[model samples]
Target: MKRTAALVALAAVPVLFLGVFFVLPVSGMVGLGLVSDGRFAPGEALEVLGRARVHRVLWFTVWAAALATAITLLLGIPAAYVLHRLDFPGRTVLRAAFMVPFVLPTVVVGIAFKHLFAGALAGLALDGTPVPIIAAMVFFNLAVVVRTVGTSWESLDPRPAEAAAALGAGGWRVFRTITLPALRTSIVSAATVVFLFCSTAFGIVLILGGLRYATIETEIYLLTTAHFDLPAAAALCLLQLFVVTLLLYAAHRARAAAPVPVERRAPGARRIRRTDLPAVLAAGVALVLIAFPVLDLVTGSLRHDGNWSLANYRALDQVGQGSLVEASVIEALVNSLRTAFDATWLALLIGGLVSVIVTRRSHSPTERRVRAGLDGFFMLPLGVSAVTLGFGFLITLDEPPVNFRDSPMLVPIAQALVALPLVVRTLAPVLAGIDDRQRQAAASLGASPLRTVLTIDLAVITRPLLAASGFAFAISLGEFGATSFLSRVDHPTLPVLIFRLLGTPGSHNYGMALAAAVVLAATTAAVMLLVERLRVPGVGGF
Candidate 1:
């Protein structure tokens, strides 16, 4: 009973925080959708649901997500296998390269894709459609495959593959018969994650697609904010929520279906054959795939009027002739930095506390239940489309108890919501690795609980803590969807600024947008480098 009480006390913080912030906001959106103009409109919602356009958009969303997932898996499985099995030089560097797109702002990605495939970009052309956008989406999300599958990839024992080879199975047969089965859990996990990203994708679709295409997310934003059709927006939100819920349910089942096999061999030590042509070619292609987009962004930023010049960069601070360019670049940059910093620290504190509490009682049933429930809620912000959350926040924050309709902190708070999951996932594993014996040793030595954490726990967690917080900071810095929804008219972030620049039909505007995107990309890359430098021993960095 005493232990249960203690567990409850610990779990209370996360539950209360999530109940107020996460659950209430989403619930309010659903309520708003149903109780519009004072009376319920379930029939209107049902009718909207049956619209042909809605069906078309839903079909498009599923197809696009599936395509993206397939692309990630095709490229990622081999890449994951190579990284998991190969012992070569630059392995860590290759791993970091995979993670770059995951951290790059979607808006920046969309912009980069546009620039890459634009008529003026190295005179390259790709049939004048949004094929570039789809390709970019697949490339940008490849990290999901590597990170998720790579974890399981690392955990795989190579003896199975080796034994299969000894039994007269060819390399292809061995991979199909043995390696594929061993990677089922990681593949499913990675695919679900990639699908979630693709379905809810906004900035990439907006920038690369323009009016040519729209995901469910971009359409919702366009319908609600641009058209002011709350009903249609609500309907879209509901449809999206249903689909996402189904996807997440599939993910949950995939997770439950596969039991991770015990590895007799060290996962880190696994490697692919050095002379394998497929592995080498895949690695080379991946390197080019990752490097070219960034190179395109950088080169575009530096060139101007058929000659290299820094004029576009120099004019980053000036506001232009319309509402789209209402805010200066300096203002946007400062606002982004300030807000991202605050949100990172805020998330670190809240998420870290929740993680520690969740791990405090390993054997308490009540604690386990509470942790599981809270975990789902915290992770909901990740899977729940950003546009949905943005609309929810807009409706709920306009009146009453919390009026942040015009608040500056609103953007970062949204960023924090998106980033909190990253922080928790990163820190939770590190915290879980803390042995009970260490705490018991401290306690036996007359250390109080606080002191034990301060000394023993602090030493172990500091490195991962830095890396995690740094990742949260980087994520918030480049975050775009929530930034678009919550950005105050007077203050914009770098991404919003870049989007506005790209929206205009002038060379200078496009050039300046490219410049700002270059800056955002460079800033993100530098921070990731910092994260690696600060990574604690034995705990993987950001």
Candidate 2:
């Protein structure tokens, strides 16, 4: 009974936070579309789904996400094997380099791909086509596959494969029969996450595809903002919510079905062999694919009017020509920093409570089930469309009893919710790994529960806590889709400002956009680099 009381106390803050910020807003948005004249009426919304344009958007979203997931797996598996299973010089640096893209802002990625296609691959004419959009998706999601699969690959026992090899079984035969089966669970989880990200992608599609090529995410934005079609947008939101819920459920089942290992083994990375050439080559290709757009973005920012200059960087202090924006890039950057600072603390507080609530050793079946439900509940933000969240905030939080239209912290609160899932993921595994006997021993020694947690949990979770903070900070810095709807014109985040610069005409505006993207990318990369240095296990994996 005491333990139940403690669990309830621990879960209260996170529950309230999500209830007010996540569930309420999403429910309000869904209600807006389904309810009419104080009565439930989904007929008009359902009719919108029958339109030909909606079919095209739905078809394109599914096919594109499927294709991107396939390519990511094909490229990521070899790279994951090479990076995690082989010992090589500069391997750590290379791993960190690959991870930078995953943390980069989606808007920055969209701009980088735009620069790459227009500048380096101009002759190929890939710009304004689905090719760049698909490539961008691959580039952004490859790290997820690498980290998720690589973590699992790193810990697998080598004895089984070695025994098979000793029996005259070739390497391919061993991998096909033994290694692949062992990796199936992690591969499936990674693919599901990558597919979820690709399907709900907004900034990349909006920037590269425009109206010519639209996905469900961008279409939702267009319907809400341009078409003023709330019912249609809300209908699409329901569709998105349903799909994401299904994906989350599938991932949960896959994880639950995975067999727990009877024995644990230390990582057994070996020196490269003759047979590793294919994997090495694939890793090299993956590196090139990651580096090209970043290189183009940097080079494009440095050049202006067919000549190299720092003029673009110099213009960061000014709004673009003809007052393209209300705030300068530098000012927007300061706003981003301040907002991220607020968001990091909020995410850490809520996520820390959530981690503790879910990781505590449950003494009863009912308690364990409740904890499991809460864990899945917090992860809804991960799969839900960010645009939907942002749009929902606008409609739901603007009226009496919950008015936040003029609140400065509204954007940070939304960003915090988006980062909460990552923070919980980062910290929960670390907390769960702790030996419960240590806590029991501490309690037997007459230490109170608070003292036990402070001495044991705090000691173990400090580095992970810091790491989660950095993740939240970096994600908030690059957040765009939600910020787009919630950020005011006078206090725009850097990403919002960069997007504005891209939309405005003039060479200077374009140049500034590139420069601003470089700044945002560098900031996020630096944070990720520091997080990597902490060497926390399962920091960024799914």
Candidate 3:
């Protein structure tokens, strides 16, 4: 009974936080579609599903996400093996470089691809096609595959493969029969996550696809903002929610199917051999794909009127021509930093509590089930559309009782919700890995529960806690979909400001957008680099 009471106490703040910030806002948005004249009417929203344009959006979202997921796996599996299983010079730097794209703002990635096609790869003529969209999705999600599979690969026992080779099985035969089976779970988990991110991608599709290609995410934004069609937006949101929920559940089931445990061995990263040429070549291609757009974005920012100059960067201190933005690029950057700082702490607090609640050794079957349910509940932000969350906030929280339309903390709170899942994912594994006997020992020594946690759990999770903070900070810095709806004109985040600048006409505006994107990308990359240095397991993995 005491243990159950303690579990309730531990879960109370996080549950309340998620209920108010996440559940309430999403439910309110769905209500807007179903409730009319105080009557529950879902038919009007469902009618949106029959629209021709909606069909096109859904089709494109599915095929594009599928294609991107396939390409990411193809490139990522070889690279993951080369980078994590083969010791090579500059591997750490290369690993960090590969991770930068995942943390980059979607708006920045969209703009970089545009510049890449227009300036450097103009002859390809793939500027406004679905090709770039798919490519960008691969570039953005490749890191997920690498991180997830590579983490598993690093810890995989080599004896099975070595034994297979000893019996005269060829390298290809051994890998196909031995290595692939071991990696099946992580591969599936990564693929599901990549598909989720691709299908729900907003800023990339919005900036690159424009009117030519529309994913469900961008379509929802257009329906809400441009068309003022809340019902249509709500319909798309429901569709997306259904699809994502199914995908996440499938991933969960795949991961839960326990693999036969092997006797553990230290990572045996061998020196590169002649046989590793193919993987090395693949990794080279992956690096080029990651580097091209970033290099193009940097060079594009330095050019003005066909001459290389710092004019675009200098213009950041001033608003664009014709008052395109209410705040200067520099001011917007300040807003982003301040918002991210606030968001980091909020995510860490709630996510830390959630990690503890879900990871604690449950004494009863009911307690275990409750903890499992809470674990999945906090991850809803990972699968739900960020734009829906932000839009919901505006419509639901503006009135009395929960008025936050004018609060400075509103944007930070929304970003925190977007980042909370990452925090929980990063910290929960570290917490769960702790031996319960340590806590029992502390308690037997007459330590209070709080003191037991402080001395035992905190000691183990401190590094992971710091890593989670940096990871959350980076995610909050790059969050755009929700920030678009909630950020005020006078206090826009950098991503919002860059999107606004892109919409405005003028070479100067375009140049400044590139420069600002570089700044945003650099900030997030620096944070991620620090997170990586901590060597926290599952820092960027699922």
Candidate 4:
């Protein structure tokens, strides 16, 4: 009875948190959009949905995401394969650190890409076009393909390929017949996630694509904020919700289709071989490609108009005070850190409780299915656009039972919502793998259920939980999508401040933006490195 009560209590926390903060706001936002004046009107929703601009935005979102996914796979697959087969110094370290780009704020990345390609694309003025936007998507999302597929590729049985080669099969033929089949499920899962991210993209689309490009996410933001067309934003949110649901469902099915476990051994970075030089060089090249934009951003911040100077860093003080954002550099940094601290605690508390409820003692098929359903539920926030959620906050939080419209907790609440899914993803896998036999053994030894959980399950997840905390902190520091909508002038996070600075004219404003982006990048990188260093040996990554 005590154990049952504990389980119920554990489930209630996440259930209540998500229901009140997430589901209620979104549902209320939709109702506000569907209703005309005081009455529910289907005609208003239909009219918004039937607009020609809506069709155009939907089409662009689909095709651009498809292009980005295809491009990412084409390059990411080769990189994953090379990293898997090669044994060299720093290989394991590289794999663990690959999340640097994935964890970066999209607004910061958008700024980096603009500088990286500004000269190259000057002839065509590609800022408002799809090319730069899709490229940015690839830059940010390639890590997904590499991590998921590489995790699978590293564990593939090599004997089958060796046997095939011995029987006169060529390398390509061996790969086609043996290696490719083993990686299909993971590859599909990675591709679907990449596609979903690119489709629901907000920061890059807005900053890079500008007004010329319109994805459903960007359109939703523009419709509500720029146009005050709540009904239109609501319609797009519905369509977005449906599309994201399908993608999440597809990703879940792909992950579920894997019949065998991947990464059976700890990642190994053995000595480099004579034959491994080519793959090693390729890996080095790949790393450089990924690392250059960041390096350039740092350099660009310090070098102003060809003369290296501290002028840009000095300008940081002038950028905020009594200026556009109204907060000093120190104030913004303090606010960001304070909010991130609160957000990380919230994510750890809520996600930890949910994971406790999700971790099962039995490995039955029904239990597995239920676990997967729970996984999908937790991850839905990630798949759903942050813009949609932000708009939901605008419409729902101004009145009634919990009128926190101007409350100080709003920023951290938004940050926590954004970080919760990642926390769950980070912690759930480790928790679910805990053998029920451990609990059973403890029970047989006369330990109570509560004691069994404390000593067994909780003890095991300690390191991974730390990793989750790092992720939550990093997310809170770098998040821009929802923060763009929710943050007020008085309290701006780094990414939000950076976006505003970049939007303003003048070289001073531009330099300050780069300087701020550098700070945000450094902050996120430090958090992720800590995570990599402290992570549990065999746990999955962000």
What local lDDT does model 4 show for residue 324? 67
lDDT of 2 by residue, 472-541 (tens): 9999999998899899988999999999899998999999999999999999999999988875865544
| Weakest 10 consecutive residues of candidate 2 by summed lDDT | 258-267
lDDT of 1 by residue, 109-138 (tens): 888877777744545567236577678878
* C-alpha-based local distance difference test score of model 1: 0.77
Pairs of colliding residues, candidate 2: none
Which tens-of-lDDT digit does each residue in 449-513 have in candidate 3? Answer: 89998998899888888888888899899899988988888889999999999999889889999
> Which RMSD values do the candidates have, in order?
2.5, 1.5, 1.5, 3.0
TM-score to native of every candidate shown? 0.93, 0.97, 0.97, 0.92
Candidate 1: where is the Cα deviation over 4 Å?
120-128, 267-275, 321-323, 362-368, 534-542
- Which structure is stronger by lDDT: 2 or 3? 2
Rank ordering of all candidates by lDDT, starting from the highest: 2, 3, 4, 1
Model 2 residue 456 distance off true place after TM-score fit, in angstroms: 0.8
Q: Evaluate residue 292 in candidate 1 and report its C-alpha lDDT on the 0 to 100 scale.
A: 83
* Per-residue accuracy of model 4 over 1-542 as CA lDDT, tens digit each: 44545555657778778877788888887797777778988788788888988888889999999999998887677677666666656666777556688888898888887876674346877655788788888888878888788777776767676799899997678878877877788888889889988998888888888777889999988988789988888888988888788778777777787665443543443455665455456555657657777777788888788789988888776654324687755567778899899999998998888777676542455655655665456555765678888888888888878787898788788889988877887888898888888888999999998899899988988899899999999989888777788888888887888888887777777888888888888888899889878876436563
**Cα lDDT, model 1, residue 275:** 49
